[model samples]
Target: MLGQIDITRRQAEIADIVQRSGFASVEELAERFEVTAQTIRRDVNGLCELGILRRTHGGVEPPASAGNIHYSTRQILNLAQKKLIADLVAADVHDGQSLAFSIGTTPEIVMQALTGHEGLCVFTNNLNVAFTASANPSCQVTIAGGRLRPGDRDVVGRSAYDFFTHYKVDIGIFGVAGVDEEGTLLDFHEDEVSARQSILANCRKSFLVLDHSKFGRTAHVRGGHIRDVSCIYTDRPVPQHIQALLEGSETRVVAAQDTV
Candidate 1:
């Protein structure tokens, strides 16, 4: 019986499952581990104590409130959806347009998608986006001066915020960690949040690119208000409440799957 497994080993497995799926109900975890619900609960409680998982209403999920997932991990998760969202956002961009990109996996994908576009001058705090956008010989890339965050490979600080204040762009593309029920955009870093706020304010048109997983998630910093975005390009429909919120604010919603 799986009941004979080592408690420590089983707990690790549970952590992996919760991290992978984002959330797992106690009953589901219990069945998978071939243990009683009480046993699974104990394992989950122990993991929670260790801060490996966070308890949810009926289950447990990865500890996300502290910060964002690692950049490497985010790059691999929901990859297909990210690609689709990128394509949708890119369609709105044209040659000779000035663009501003925010730091995020989805924005990186958008940069890759724009690799061949000509006469584009891009400004960004994301090193990866700046580098990728520069791959198109005709595109000029500008990096904002700020405190470089090696882990996320992005720059953010008062300097980055000041950098964006000097010029307005034709389009601003960004990704957020979460869009809560109240239609607030949120992220994990204070400097990054401030940088995005500057980008949004300085751009003529602002697009928010995100996968469906961002819905209902939580991030500690307030990025901005959803009403400020010109349009949202996502792989799937946003939550019904969010949709209504956008409509009321005169923001457009582009569901990539439906468009294709």
Candidate 2:
């Protein structure tokens, strides 16, 4: 039996890991903490009740939205790499080209990179992206209408999907939480997935911006397949299996300052 202080500290550590990794299994958390599975389950249940964690199939994850990890945490996770990929993708955007920005830290960085572009029409479900891009003197920013996620400052659901259906953009910029072995794009929320699918179906060309950390990660929902993307911009090399999939499909991989 652990003391109150010990239990508190251990739970805190467990929450930190789940926030950083996006997901953690009960058995793995048990082994890592040197505790029995039953004990870990108790801790997870408590955390879930407190709204610090969400129960998944055989593990726990950060809450789907609003209760997700902080934007600051997401911002700092891959700052340098995100900036590199943002620069590479932004360079592709020409003046007067219309673009849609998805909800993610990477898309926010890309919005920053697009500052001062002339005659550009930008549509986004991310409130942060809309506000930031609005600061560009020559850009027109349109935000999707829907239930807002105060946590991430984004919009989702049918309203957002309907908004995207009205206009087809020249470019669609998106981010994913995971890319599975078969090259499917995965994310945490089904509503966001639906929004992404709408953007993919309407856009002339689509680009996925991601870091290497997403390579083997797992998420609950599938947004779409990689073959639907026109290109992928990343800060690291694509893993061999994913690379093979891209090569056999229509997707082109763009690596920035990649070592692997």
Candidate 3:
């Protein structure tokens, strides 16, 4: 078995490459990392055990599914990367801004990062985000009226959608379950899609926050396109084909690694 640190770093890199490219052969991975094919296999096996990657005949690819991972598990996955993306996003937000935040762990982190800002009005369906944003005494937090989703600590449904549509916000920050190969945003449930659509439509500036692992992942509920957002804050550069699509568009892609 590989050392804990080594295994984590290698597997994370491998997962990112496979997610962005759709698939990666063992030989290609071994060559790219200057490691033996056997070592690459070991890393692949570990990722497969985590259910994030599926083994192919000669390579690995993201698991094909419409369901998202457990919320607790998602909270810790790529946490460091999410924090970096959040910090960059919070830096762009000024005090006294009216913001709408959609549900997700990354959005919660962004709210946490904004707790120091004063005179902000935050609208959200996510209980976690509401609590975090309220930590700033000067910020006013409004949560939606809907049945709580205990698993995700958020609310979703017609009520959530209507709540977001009622207010026009200066900035809308949201996260998606996946970004398909065609650059469409996806989520596990129709309610999530509807709520996110309302956010995008009502905000003057929309920001999509996601880590690299979301790039080529699969989800059944389609909402919007990547180009629909005003800015994308992610941990890694987008795939080549996605980059080509964003060219000359109003959307700005900000990778934390490039900025730092």
Candidate 4:
């Protein structure tokens, strides 16, 4: 329960966190706004429902896309880092390459970076991704048809999955919510796992473009082991043990920011 003044202040505080940190947590927000955790939860729930902040487990991150693409309770996150990684991944693409891009912030960056590449084909379930790629004359892009997610411009569900079954690509690239000690990719939804599995099965090669913070973490659902991927592009030098596990599984780890 919160007094009117307290509630107003907390809401503004949550907005401030989203505006500044790009993400913030219930507990941290509670402490900052000098309110109870329950009050923060209420604010977060209400604000997310209102499209003021994106919410996530323990916190919130920025939406990958704005407008009709807002989904979940997660707040803003790691925009600069995501952009950096996107530029790096884009550099790997060339003319006449086909790529499968998934629905994630980093993938959005990759799409932006590829706007000028010629003769590129992009297959994506993310409407924004497909739209972004299509804008570049260099790309011939197709979107997977499915029920669109409210918060994300992703066309998830049966139709999209079925669409994926119809085509093969040179590479499938995506970012995961987490990476495990066993070197598996993990996420928050089973359908996403299923979609990625289909991508892995169909693509000639696959890539996991992740940031360092994702290493040694686990989300609610398991995507697959690292070896299931052809390569992992990341921004950090992985821990020795994680590096060894990746090597053991024959998954090449490419530090996206590495000068070499």
Error of 1 at 104 (Å): 0.8
Per-candidate Cα lDDT values, in order, are 0.84, 0.83, 0.88, 0.72
Name model 1 segments beyond 4 Å from true. Answer: 1-66
lDDT of 3 by residue, 1-260 (tens): 10012346777778767866989999999999999999999998987876668999999988885568755446656878998999999999999999999998899888888988999999999988888877778999999998888768889899999999999999999999999998999998999999999999999999999999899988898998999999999999999989998998999999998897
Q: Top lDDT: which candidate number?
A: 3
- Count of backbone clashes, every candidate in sequence: 0, 0, 0, 17
TM-score of predicted model 3?
0.76
Give per-residue lDDT, candidate 4, residue 224: 78
Question: Estimated TM-score per prediction?
Answer: 0.77, 0.74, 0.76, 0.72
Off by over 4 Å in 2: 1-68, 258-260
Which regions of candidate 4 deviate over 4 angstroms? 1-76
Q: Itemize residue pairs with steric clashes in candidate 2.
A: none
lDDT of 4 at 72: 28
Residue 139, candidate 2: C-alpha displacement in angstroms: 0.5
Error of 1 at 144 (Å): 0.8
Which ranges of candidate 3 are over 4 A from the true structure? Answer: 1-66
Q: Write the per-residue lDDT of candidate 4 for residues 1-260, one digit (tens) a residue.
A: 00011225456556656755788877877888788999888877776666566778898755555322233222224444556677777778878988988877677667877888899989888776787787777689888876887556687777766777788899898878788887778887777777877778888888887777678765778877877888777776677777777665767777755644
Better of 1 and 2 by lDDT: 1
Residue 93 local lDDT, model 2: 88
